[model samples]
Every structure is written in C-alpha cells, then in structure tokens.
Target: MKKTLNINIGNSIILIEEDAYEMLTGYLNEIKFHFSKNADHFEIVTDIENRIAEMFREMLLQQQKQVISIDDVQLVIAQMGSVKDFENADEAEGGIYEETISGVKKLYRDTDDAYIAGVCSGLGHYANIEAKWFRLMFLVSFFFAGSGIVVYLIMWILIPRAATRSQRMYMKGEAVNLHGFIRNFEEELAGNQLISRSRGFFVELAEAAGRIVRTLGKTFFKVVAWLIIILGSCFFLAMLVGMAVFLGFSDANPNEYFPLNIVNDAYLSSMVFAFFVALAIPIIALVLFAIRVAFNSRAINRTVSFGLLVVWLGGVMLSIFYITKVASEFKEEAEFSQVRELKKYDAYTLTLDRSRFFSRADSVKYQINSDKYRGKVILNDMDDPYNLPRNVRLNIEKSENGLVTLTQNNSSHGKTFEAALSHAQNIHYDFSQQDSLLNFSPFLQLNRNTKWRDQEVTLTLKVPVGVKLILNEEMDLFSYSFDYWSCEDHGAPKAWVMTEEGLKCTKP
Candidate 1:
C-alpha cells in the first residue's frame, strides 16, 4: 500500500500517492526553472500550475480514481510536453505567436465574463463567435419564448465550468501545450488578443443598458417579494385572529345566517380547519420567500419544502371536498302548503296589527340585518316586527259559496322534500278575527331551529257576492302594494262590495 497525501490543485482538493505527488512537484519545478529565464516567468509558471491542478481535478472526478498514481503524473507531463520541445525556438521571433489552432474544442462554462452562468460564453467560444452575439440571441429568445433562461439553467447544471488556464485554452480551440499556454498568458497580460476586446460606442452603450436593466429588474423583483411577504403575512395574521375570535365565542344566532345554520357543528369545524390550513400554507410560504429575499437569508431545506408542499396540497383537497359537501345541501328542494277557512261574518274588515304579531311567548332579544330581499331588511327575534321579506302575493276573487274563505300557501326549500316541508311548516303566520275585523300579520316568522329557505306566503281572499269589504290604510303593508284611491277627497272612507267580477268601488 502506498501513502497518499491531500493537495489543493487550483481551487480543487485531491488525493495523490506520495510518489505521484513528488513527480508532479518535480515536473512543476522543472517548468519553473525553464521559465525563470523569461521576464514573465511568474505568470507562465502560475498558469502552468493552475493547468496541472485542473487536469488532476478532472482525472479524479471523471475517472473515479481515489488516488493519483505516478503513471497519471507521467501521462499529464507527456501530454503537456517538456521545455526542451520549444527550447530551440528563436528568441528574435519578437514573441509573435503562430496560429496554433486545434479542432478538438471542449465545451465549458466561462466564469470570467459570465452575467448569470457561463453557458453562453462557452457556447460562443465553441462556435467561434462573439459572446455578445450569443447574449443578443438569448435576449431576443427571452422575449419570444422565455425559454432562454430555462435552457441556460439546464446548460449551467450540465456543463463543467472552465476552471483552469489549460481548460480555458482548450475551450477556445487552442493547444494545451506549454508554448500555447505561455503565449495565451502573455497575450492576456499584455491585453493583445484576450477573450474580451475594447468595443465601439454601440457595444459600450448596449453593455450599459444591459447593466441598467439588470439593476432595475433586480430592484423590481425585490419590491414584489417584499410586498408579497407583507400582504401575505397581514392576511394570514388577520385570518388567525378571526379564527381565534370565533373559537373564543360562539355565534349568537346561527339561524340568522341560514346557510351557516344548515352546517352542523362537526362538519363546520372540519371545513373551517381545512380552509385555514389550505389558505395559510401558501401564505406562510410567500412570507418565508419574502423574508429570504429581503434579508438574503438561506433557502429552506429541500426535504422540508417538499413536505410542506405535499401537506398544502392535502389541505387544498380537503378544503375542496368540504366546500362541495356544504354546497350539496342546497341541491334538492320542496315546499309545504295549507289553507284555512274563515268564520262567516256580515261585514269584514282587513287591517295589519303589528302589536299582536310580535307578542310571542319565547321571543329573544336577537336582531340581525339581513340582505335576503331587494333592500336591507331587519330581522328581530323580540319586539321589532320586520323579520323577513314580505313577499305576500294576494288576489281577491268572488266565492261560489256565500261564506268567506281564506287560502294560505306557505313555501320553502331544503335538501330534501321532507326537510323543506318541515322548514316551511315551521313558519308562523296569524290572520285571526275580532268580530268582523280580520287582523293580519305583514311578515312571516321562522323559528330558530328552522333554517331559512326562502320562506314566503301567498294569501288568497274569496269574498261572497254582495258582501261589503273594508280595506284600511294598513292594506298598503301588504307586499303587493294595493293601489286603492281613498284620500282627503273622500275622508269618509270608500267601501268595496264584492261583485260577480271582483271587488267594486262603492260609496259607504
């Protein structure tokens, strides 16, 4: 077994056998000694060392070799060639290099002049074109397809970065030997024919515009991120506070909001919890992302992020399921109707009596402002009488029999016919008699246990022919808006007698 030593080559760490390490060191020393006679000896030697380090790193990574052997070092040296190969070259050549091009060019990411990744730069070098051309091509494609960024990211992930002098030379289709390496380094130092050259006015202007755009784009993204964070956090916190308040206190009269009344305690709790979780996860994620953008914080762990995403998805599914479940309750509908006969009387009068209507035995002090009708309506459980919409449709017709008859059709809806009928039956309406005067309630009342299902009443009055009917001013309270003309001109009050056709105006 040979002893191995850990060494850092360029910016890469590698393991090399003791004999291999000594050979590599000796080879570098020889190159240094040869280049020592030149004015740019340091530059040439440093470039060579970086090249050797890069080669070692590649061998270790690509070949899966745990330790570099002496044979590996010898192979690298042979490929690079020795100082004797170029020792006889004329110094009077004015350091002018011949075109030592190579057809075998390797693709690499150029980190030196890269804006985001060096993929474009590497592509430019491989295609023997200017990097600006690749940049322009990518920029144009970015607007058309927005696919340039995705392709760039994929290329960045797949292509190896050009990390050393020798690899960079190979990427540019230049020879990797000592003479080429020294020539390239000298050109780079002297600013002759390096990767980037001085540009004309348009090129400089384009570069400046690119810089400004990049800066503005970065600022805009940061502002958007911050806004998302603030808005998400505020909404999330507000929802939490609402939930907290709900948990602390129960709704005073859930029947006031009939849709909520149908939702049982068990399902209501589950649906609310699922809704909160489903809504909160994305909001929290946005907040976290915003925090990261604002503070330049480290990203969350991938495992945790994936787990949160899965959990959020489950919450969303649960929320959708409960929402569908709740919505299904209104799918079916039914109504209940009944009619009652009125006792015979000589002369009948109709008037709305608000006092006797709200005089209930078990009335509570709960009032709710409801939007169940065209305008705002008040619903009071105790004293106030305008509880529900007064959708009372009425028609007066001549009765075949002499006795007057009143017909009432109360209608409502529910998930099932039976449920709907039960709710409709729960509605309480009063139209009783005091001698010949009939007292009617303007609005219908639904008890607390009965969920609202658009409950309404239709009252039909059948009056015998020759019967005198007295309709007071309170007839205006009837939802149909009865427009009978009897004002200061006829202060004595006009009486209508039920004729064969309908109610006819007659002098009282």
Candidate 2:
C-alpha cells in the first residue's frame, strides 16, 4: 500500500514509488547543481539521465516489474555512484567511483582509430585483444578467396559507430560518471583536436559537405547491398534448380553431350558435383553476406561460415584434379586416310544430307517404327550447334591421274596413338553416290557410349580436267579449305570446274 507517481526522465515515462521518485529527484538535482558551472553541464547531465533511464529499463525488463521500487532505485544509484563518490574519485589517485561501471565495456566502432571503419578497434576493446592481431588475421584471410573483404563489410554494417562521448567511454571500458566525463573533456581540450580547433566559414562548409558525402555514401551502399541480396538470392536459387535437374538426369547418359563427353564416365558424377560445389558455395556466401548488410544482422555463425569455406576449398581442389586428369587424355593425336575410286562422270551434283542414319541401338532408343515409316527419311535437327565441336571439313582438288577419286581422312586425340586411332575409327560419317548425285553428311557421329576425343573427318574429292561439279547452298558449312561463300553467285547454287592447276569456281 504505497503512493506511486509518474515522472519523465530522459524522454522516458517512469512509474516510481513516491519515496523513490523523491530520492531520484534529489540525486539528479545534486548532479545538475554540481555541474552547473561546467561549460558542457547540459550535455553531461543529459547523458547521465539517459544512462540512468537505460539502466532502469533494463532492470524492469530483467526483473519483470513494471514499476520502479526503492530497492531498484538504490541499486541504480549505487551502480552510477553518488555525487560525493565522484568528487572523491576526482581527488583519489587512480581510484574509480564504480569498479563495475568502469568494467562495463560495449562493442562500438572506434572511428577515431579506424583505418577503414574502426571494427577492429571496437572488437579489440570488447575482447581485450590487440587490434593489430585482428587486422593481421583479416589480412591473412584475404588470401583465402577474398573472404575477409565480405566479413569486414558485414561487420561495418552491423556494428554501430561510437558517436557520443559517453558511447566512446563505454567502448573504451571507461566509467561514464561526472569525474570520468570531466577528465575526458579536459584530455580532449589538452590535445587541441577538432573540439578545440577554431573553425572558419570555409572549414565549416567543408565539414558540412563531407558529412553530406558520407551520408550519401552510406545510402548508396545500403542500396547496393539490397540489390545484391535480391539478385544473389535469385541466382543462387537458379543454380540449385540447375544442379537438381543435372543430378536427376545423371542416369540418362548425360555424358553424351559435347562438354560432358570430354570427361570419363566413371568420374563424371564426382566431377559435376565438385564443380557445383565450387560455384554454388561462392554464390551462397555472397547472398548471405548481402543479407547481413541489408538487415544489419548476422545471417550465419562463424563456425558455419568456416565449414562452408572448407567445403568450397575441397570442391575447388577436386575440380582441379579432375580437370588435370581429363586434360591428359588428349596428349597424343592420330590420323588415318582411305582412298576410294568414284564412278566417272563429266558433271556431278553435290548436296548436304540432313537425313539421320540411325543404327539398331538408336532405333531402339528412339522407339522408331520402321514399318510405319519405311520410305520416310527422318531429318536430323541441328538446333544445338554446340552439341559437338565442328568435326567435318571438305576440300575439292584436281585429280593427279585421269580418274576421279575420293579420300576420307579421320583424326582423333587420346592418351596414346593407338587409343587416338581407335577413337578416330569410332567416328561414323555418311557419304553416298546415286547416279550423278553425291550426298555428304553435315556432321560426323560418335559410336554409342564412346567418349569424345576430338574426332574429326576431312573429305577430299579429286576430279579430272574439264569435269564440272554443282554444290548445294548448305554444303558451304563443311567447306573450310575453299572460299565457298566468296564463289557464290546471286541466289544460285555454286558451280566449280577441276582443271590441271586446281578447282576453279564458275560464278556464271
């Protein structure tokens, strides 16, 4: 049964017992009267009141009480120390008014000592470790994939800068009493720094401009961080979906594709997973970092970050190992050529063959109904141009003898010459002659389940003197040795004549 009164302190509404309120009022009045003669008396008193309000709020939250009791007021007074205690502290050599208060250190960016953002200096105060050691650790971490830069940026965003004298004192583990405040103020005055420096109109204007630039810079960084969070998250999700799709199709001969075909089937899965890890981990880290910067909170703990780093390194190493192993398979190259006599003709029409020559395995895989489509020629679609490298080339030359002949040169690369020759032999190319018409496949195909080893086919057609040949419009794609496009007539199929010297284009 006691009378309670509502009072305003440091812009906070506090409900206190009548006796407690009276005691708090007396204490504050004593502090104000004592500091009334000081130049920064208003600032000092405001800070003290703010500190007391914070302590009261903390006490209420911690003790689960809505109203301040006499005991709570006494505890706060003891922690903050009385005006007499502060005076004694000023007189006593190296004797702080409140040991517990002096020991209460807070984490804040010490911008005064900062090379960048004062994060190391602030951490040094909180952890009681040298800032130089933290700097060294960050510098060393930079070599490990520039992870240090991300960490430093995140810390800068999350840790608040010490802006006020009391905050600076807290950051440095100093008491925030009247004695300590006066001493700090005197030290700053003695240093003759910014506070004591005389400011002219231009200097003040320059400082104002600097402040505006700093504020704009902060705003710009926040915008960039938000953009990164949005874009990085989307990219990360896409990568995850891509990895899932790839792994889902792992059993369905994914190695038949061009680049994947370069790797051995036995270790293809491992190599793909390693590559995914190497790429995906960095995106994940970037997204997490952006989230931290945008939200001003830690997205993950140090242990999880370190673990991710280790996994990323492992993936990179594994990818390198696989890449080296795959590269060694293309060390040697082998080529073989075969000559065949062609039926003599004065004029021949050459055309590109788009029809696919499906083997028994391909027919079974495609579930083609041979009886239903007996006479139908299924045209192979060339939608995916990079499904394989350009593996076909054509050349026309004058015949050394009076007879017409065709030569096919096959080439491939592998670990050994024999292996390369075997790979070359595994290549299947289509070429056929019907009357005076010659048909050539647009691209060469690999045998079923055969790994690609840069297999290629080069065809050379030798014709006697005065023999004329007509070329299809699409045949230019396969003729690299001859300037096929340069010999093209307006909207007409190209024609050529083989003479004693070489093949000559007849534009007319």
Candidate 3:
C-alpha cells in the first residue's frame, strides 16, 4: 500500500505511487550519473522521465496495484532502454522548430499545399485527424465564402515547422520508439524481420542476379530516357515556337469575334499545344520505361524519380494556383444574359472560314489580320460531320434596359459539351451584347482532330425595347456562319443573311 503523487503528460494526468516514485527517482539518478558528462542534460533527463512515467502507468494497469511499488519501479529501471530508444520514445516532440522549441507538439505554421493556408490538412496530419473533417469544420465556421482559409493562412505565417528529427518524422507519419529502441532492435533481429528486404536470401539473390543483368539493362535505359528526355524537350520547344508564331500573327492582324471568336481560337490553339507538350513528356518517359522492361531493369533511379516527382508536384501546385485564381475571379460574377438584344444595334460579323484552325496558319481571319492578338483561334472540338451539333443555336435578345444579349448554345453530348466549355474557359471567352449588334467574342478554343464545325447557323434576332424595324439579309437566316444582309426601314433582324449593301429587306 502506498500514497500517490501526480505527474502530468500533455493534457493527461498520471498518478504515481510513493513506492514507485522513490524507485523512479533512483533510476533517474542512475541516468543522471550516466549522462553526467553529456551537454544535453535537460534533454536526457526529460526523456528518461517520460519513459519512467509511461511504464509506471503500464505497471499500475498490469499489476492492478493502486500504488506503483518500489519493486515495480525497479522493474522499470531494469526495463530502462538504450539511449537511442529512450531518446526516441520519450523525446519531447521538442516543438515544431528546433531553434524555438520548448516542448512537444509545438503548433507551427505550415505554408504548404494551400491557397490561403494548408492549416486544415497539415494540422489534421499532425494530429492524426481526417483532413476532410477539418475542412468541413473550417468551412462551417465561416458559413460562407470559406473564410477559414484566411485563418489558416495566418496560422501558416505564424507557426513554425517541427524542428527535432523525431518531431519532423512524426509530422510525416513516422513513429518514434524512444523507450523500446533496443528492445525493438533485438526483437527484429530475433524474428529475422525483413524491414527492407535487405540482406535476406531473396534480397541477396536478387542483388546478385540484378547486378549481372540490371547493370546492362540500367545502362540501356539510361541511354533511352536520355534520348526521350531530349526528343521530348525538342518537341515541346517546337510546339512553343509554333504557338508563338501563330499567336504573333493573330495579334498582328485580328479577326471577327462572333459568338466568342477569340476564345474559340485561343482555346483550340492552347489546348492542342498543351496536349502535345503534356503527352510528349509522358510518352517519352513511357518509351524509356518500355525499353527498361525489354532490358529487365528494376526501379527507376532515385535521383530521376525524385526529380520527376518534384516536377509533377510543381505542375499540380501550379494548376491549383491558377484554378484558384480563376475561381476567385468568377466569385462575384454569375449571370446569364440572353441573346436577341444585340440585333437592334448595328453589329458586324467576322467570318470564321478557315478549317484546321489549330494546326493550319490563316485558318481564321484574325490570324490572317490581327496585330493585337495573343494567340491563334483554334476550334475546341467538333462532332462527326454526320453527328454535327444538334440544337445548336444563336439568339439576339434586346433587354428592357436597352442592352442586347446574344447567346450561343449547343446541345452536344455531356462529355463533348464539357470539352467545349473547358475550351471556352481556357481561352477566356464569354458572351455579352452592347449597342446594337451582338458581339460574340471568345478568349480561346481547343483543337479537335477528325471532327470539324459544320457550315450552318441558327438565328433569332430580338429588337430593342419599344423599337421595331424592317430589315433585309441577303440569305434567309436559319443560322449559318456568314449571312450577308442589308437593312433599310427596320429594327435588326434576329435572323438575316448578310448583303453586300447591308440588311436588304425586313420581315416580321
């Protein structure tokens, strides 16, 4: 029977009996003696203390003794682990930053993988919680606009990363076995554990066989990866050059942006170039991989893997950055304007007549003429000529406020439509009507192989509020790319054919 003394670990309080306390004190004295000459007396002592406390608790549980006895304390001392294990298991997480650490579990700011702050993910990982829950909680706290991101950013800027080796390893999901270091070592050796498949029968066999075969194979692959890396580099560079020239040509001239012309063009060009560049690197790597397979190579080089991993990580990060930027831009703008508004105003239509705009020069008029352009207008995609865009439509709506709204829509398959929408966003294209004519302008387009937009337009012209007129388009406006027209006494025709003289006639 013994009285108890309290010890605290983190937020948890531990009860130690008088007998155990005395015994623990004796063991501590021994450790102090052994580390007497060490410079880190504080660290050594702290580690030993935590280990003593943990074992004392374990003893109380196992022996069903309310008090930790001197015998139990002696047993703990007997269980006193090697310096390495003691250091590891009982090591105070030593704070997040080595320079600023005072104790374990220091809350340091993390600035990785976040637009504002990766606080949720980082902290979740540190605390062993699901990142999703943190994100939900963070979002819930703000109620709207995800304001927790800002708080996280603040935390990131203020917190420091775990400094101690042990702390850092824990942050990265590694365990620290300070008290069991030697025991674990002995256990591993006794069990003949294959921690890394190293120095084992199979490992030795593999090492020998691989050495004889892989050296040759590795050499061959190194050569191939080198070639692919070079060739892929050249291909990507060439695509860049071509894009630059085409964009320069388009900017120097300019083209008609009807129903998002520039966006369509730019989207097409950028996507084609990007696809070529993106796939080239992967393909080149794959080629090297194939060669490696043929030659019977093992894993990729650590350096090469590490380098590629960094590059891929960078790409993902950059993509997130850009997406976040764009999403922010759209946060304040969400309105759908109808077409038909622009028909009341005098508008000009620039014809997109060139085929293969993505790969062919002068495929669009702007490329043939513009000097203010940043890139060529490339078509994002087209259905098979046989399965061409159905429910494809164009309308000019005159709003009550004298604003014209022109809308272009297509009823295509979901995937194909998504591709088209992606093209529109990538190229910076949007639709709005002003003055009299519907201004269809696009920021970009995507390249579509084997499928092309057909020559047909559907049109519905809307007159301005309280405005009416008679108009003439050279051709009946069903909806076509180029409808020549001339107008006299009339409001603009929602559907009109372009005439050399202008809108020629008017209809109800």
Candidate 4:
C-alpha cells in the first residue's frame, strides 16, 4: 500500500492503494480540465465522473489483490452495457417463446396488501392490462367456477419479477434510457447495492445466509399473495352464486333441507355482511397491495396479512359462540311435559331429551337396584332435532352381573341417564310406607317455592304394597299441590310401583 490513500470518487466510496488513487484522480482532473468550458458540458462531465468512479470501485474488489491496477479499471469499463449495443437488441428480440411471453404478460397474482387484490390493481402490473379489466373479469368469474383467485396466486409465485433495468422499463412502457442516462443509472444502482469487501469467509457465509433468508421470505410472500388472490376471487363468486341461488329458490320451499324455523333475520344479516365483506375486501386490498408492489414500503404487507388472519379467526370463534348460546336458550324455553297416573304403566321409563345436545356425548351407563341394592347409570345422546324428529328412543338392558346399560351409536361427546327396576323380590322400595329415617330437607322446604327458584311439585302419597290402606283426603293432589303443573289430578305418586311377578320403579 502506498501512502496518502483517502479518496472519494463521485460519491462511489472506493478505497484504493495510495498510488492507484493518485493516478486515477490525476486522470479525472486532466479530463475535467479539458472539458471545463464546453457547452452541453456540466452534466456531461459530472455523469462521466460518476461512471468512472463506479467502474473503479468494481475493479478494486474483483481480484482482491492489494493494489487496484489501471488494467482492472479498463476491464470493468469494457463490461458495462453500451447504449448502442442495447439499441441493437434485435438479436435478442425473440429469445423468449412467443406463446410463453403472451401468457406471462396476461397473468396477475396477489402479493402483500394493506387492502385487497383480486381486481385491476394487481392485474395492472402483472398482466400489462389495467387493473379494471382484471377486476371485471374476476367479478364475472365469481358467478361461475370461482376459481380465478386460486389461479392468480399460483401465477404470482411462479412468475419471476422484472429484475433488470431494461426489463423494468419495458414492463412499465418507459423509453430506453439515453447513453448518459443509462450510465448514470448503472452507477446509481451499484451505489445502492454495494458488495462487502470482507476477507473473512464466515462473514461472507453469514451475509449469504441473510440473503437466502430474504429471498425465501419474498418468494413465500409472493406465493401467498397469489393464493389470496385466487381465494378472494372464489369468495366473490360464492357471494354472487349464493345470492342467485337464494333469489331463484325464494318462491320454492326448502323446508325439507333446513330446520323448521331456520330461516330468520340473523341468517339474512350475516349473509349480507358476508357478501359485502367478500366483495369489498379483495378490491381494497388490491389497491394498497398494488402501491406496495409498484413502489415499496416498510413491510406493511405482513401487517395486513396478520390483521386479516385475526379477523378471520374472530369470525369463526364468534360463530361457534353464537350457535352454542342459541342452542342453550332454545332448550331452556322448550318444555317436556308428561304427567300420568302411576297405575297407567306397570313399569314406567322417563327419558331426557338428547336432541338439545351436540356431538359432545359418547358414553352411556345404567343402574339396576332391588330394595336391597343400588348403583350408577349413564347414557349417550343420539337425539338430533335438526336432522331427526323429536322423539324418545331408548332400550334398556341388564347384564348378568346386575349392571344396566343404555347407549347410542356414533357419538364422541356426551352422557345420559338410565335407570330401571329389577326384581321386586329382593329389591324392595315401598313409596307409600315412607321410612321415618328418610330426610325431606330437599323435598319439602316451604320457603323454597318453585316460582322463587325452588318451587314445589305436588305428588299424593300412595298406599304401601301388602298393607291394607284406607282413603286419605290429603291424597287429593290437585288441591294440596303447591304447583298444580307438577302432578295434575293423576293417581297418587309412588316411591316404588310394584309389578305383578315382581318389578318396581324406584331410584336410590
């Protein structure tokens, strides 16, 4: 290295050996002095200096030998594309296949967007056509296959961007830059994207890795953007088709496919909002996205994607919540009333309505007890009022070991209750002959009325089996009942109703 090496050539920031810098500067000064007074001169000289400085920087780094030799500068200068040669580009005119070119020029893919992308906004750049036509095309497709969006995304990721200056100019329909203008731009591009002069391979590796990551990120984004475009197109089409279906079938009864009271205000409101959201979101995104694609921004596209995802998740969760709330309320309002005389059936079975439950019920169990022994009973929910009519269907079975079972098929979600009497011989539960030890704390608390959260139901005491019983006026359940709805003028209620051979209905 020679002494006195600090040098700034046309803002290119080249670092050269002392002797090399001196020689290069001497040449530039001589050239400037020669053209110092010429017309069409000031800009011409400045641009020359800019180009020379750019070449010198490249020469310094190419071989990486300590000194920047004059020969290296000449070699770099030779590599620069000349305006005359570019003008003679008829040689490369048809290098790309004609069919491929035509197709390439017509494709549009969604990229990142602060708004939407399915319309003219995204298509304008990719297809060389104004975004308006693309938007209209997509709108039309919305009524058909609804697949334009998906196609758009696939195209975006697959298509390479116009990287070269010439390519960009062609893409935007700009005229080729003049000789001096091209030189100025080349210098500017070099300045904007300078390479590192580090000797460490590790540093170079790290930089390479960083570049790979950035490339990967951009590719991923472009691919995702295209997919979004296709999906948006599909969504738009879906909305249109949905409306048409509704209109065309409005006069026809669709009650067979839908629930009895399914069509309502909430459904209509949701459909309307969904349509607007589908139709407007993509177009809006396309505009903001077009801005980013054509220009540049601070990763605003990622922010938009993230926001859209959040809103989508919110909609899903909100729908599930709404369904659950409505189902619960409906069950609470619906009543299951059946009060009959105890004498009506020898063995009575009470079943809880399972239609009110979702797929959360899977297992079922049952319990069998004589007056002497008792246990647990469980059941599964198979009742679906939406798909099946409201009706009770239960078949009880008792195992040899005395365990009772009640079950429904094809569910993974809930539990049900099942209880039936076995032999009255060993299992003896007499409802009428009430045991003095049995506590009525929960059964009979006058303060806890049914209307005030703990209302009572009236059940007249029945006569015990094997016992001679006389008429009891208190057995008039209708008059003595705290709540008449509990057990109307039906015969006396029982703790255990005895059957002929020996079957009793009683729960422990």
lDDT of 1 by residue, 1-508 (tens): 9999999876668799999999888888888888887899998887877888888878878888788999889989997887776475434343223334443688997766677656788999999899999999889889977998777656765677775676787788876666555755766766754455454555455446545665676688799998988899899999999776655566554334545555656677667778888989988888888888877895687888889899899989998998777666556666556666787876788876654433232334423323232243233323324345555666667889776787888877667878777777877876778878887776676675555566778888887888887777766657542346632225554477887777777766
Candidate 3 residues 1-508, lDDT tens each?
4578885733346776776676666666767776776799878688767777677677778878666566776676667754556567546454235333333343432333332334566677777776678778887978768687567544544454443444454455654445244445656665785443223454345335434554666577677776765676677677767667755676532223222222234354444444444444465566557556555674477788667656655655554554454334333311222344344434443222212223332345224544443354435333222222322344434444555344443211112444433433322222443343333322123233212222222344443444433222322323433333333334444333334333333344
Segments in model 4 whose C-alpha atoms lie over 4 Å from true places: 1-199, 255-260, 263-336, 341-508
In terms of TM-score, the best-performing candidate is 2
Clashing pairs in 2: none
Instruction: Give the lDDT ranking, best first.
Output: 2, 1, 3, 4
> Worst ten-residue run, lDDT, model 1?
368-377
Return the TM-score for candidate 4, rounded to 2 decimals: 0.27
lDDT of each: 0.72, 0.82, 0.47, 0.40
- How does candidate 2 fare on TM-score? 0.60
- C-alpha positional error of residue 232 in candidate 4 after TM-score superposition, expressed in Å: 2.9
As a TM-score, model 1 comes out at 0.45
Best by lDDT: 2
- Tens-place lDDT digits, model 2, residues 179-219: 55566776777678656444455544544544565677778
Better of 2 and 3 by TM-score: 2
lDDT of 2 at 90: 56
What lDDT is reached at residue 198 by model 3? Answer: 28
